[model samples]
Target: MSNHELGTVQVYTGNGKGKTTASLGLALRALGHNFRVCVIQFMKGSSEYGEYKALEKFENATVHLMGRDTFVNKEAPEVEDVELAQEGYEKARESMISGKYDIVILDEVNVALDFHLIEVEQVLELMDIKPKNVELVLTGRNADKEVVKRADLVSEIKEVKHHFQKGIPSRKGVEH
Candidate 1:
């Protein structure tokens, strides 16, 4: 078994970018230390992301992509979107309790919760039941207040300015 210390719930949320990036950075750090890591991405199905390709190279890391490549409609999400989010949640819960992973990153899970693809109560319960040794990281915008309250560390990445404001489209390897 890994010798990592007890893990705490960390929430990275805001209207700005870098929530996923921050969690992935943590994943990379954990992997560098030879810790088992599981990343279950909610509302993100495309394998084209650069992080997916990079993380795949690590034998100790498992990345599960959940959702379609298309954007989810926040006002009226498709039934399939909901299904995928639920599946992702189940996978995350299992990963946390299985004792196989030292770090579990639920990518875009906050967005999933905000869009009503998954219930806040469910996420709260998952936090409660998380194994003491497994670090749980939740990322995305519009994080619920309750989640923020319960998290051991909350980082709000506010966007003071972004390239998108300058009419610059998402650049390859930078935004993606």
Candidate 2:
């Protein structure tokens, strides 16, 4: 029962919360099954997040933060943001092809695409070349239509209700 038999493309996207959380949950579940996972965070560049600290306990999981800690202006992203995302995408593509990991998560990559930090064509190309044995997960808001069409499983989280709407700020271990 190897995890490498029929890996598929999964996309978690929308305006709702938990897209990243859902992807992380999948990584944890995969790790529980002794699968190696690699998570490439496109627009997060800090170790301050709780998931960053918690995932350290799993030797089979690796996380790469590839952006500044500050916010990115979607209308006009900084050069650093673009560069980091490009670097992260390159690493993710390499990992997918390396066959060293059973699951590869490109966290916030959809947002990166929506904000024009990276092109959809490149992402689509990566998906095209992805090895059949490597599960690919892409997460973030505003996932492109083409990406959705390409994914084997697409989950669009709808924000029917959220604590943030009630003015509750993002809490550690819950929203980080």
What are the RMSD figures for all models against the true structure?
0.8, 1.2
Query: For each candidate, how many residue pairs have backbone atoms clashing (under 3 Å)?
Result: 0, 0
lDDT of 1: 0.94
Using Cα atoms with residue i matched to residue i, what is each candidate's TM-score against the true structure? Answer: 0.98, 0.96
Cα lDDT tens digits for candidate 1, 1-176:
56877899999999988999999999998899999999999998999999999999999999999999999999999999999999999999899999899999999999999999999999999899999988999999999999999999999999999989899998879878
lDDT of 2 by residue, 1-176 (tens): 24559899999998898898999999989998999999999998989999888888898888889999999999999999999989988999898998788999999999999989999998998899998888999999899999999899999999999998899998887787
Give, for candidate 2, the lowest lDDT window spanning 10 residues.
1-10
lDDT of each prediction vs. the true structure? 0.94, 0.91
Number of the predicted model whose TM-score against the real structure is largest = 1
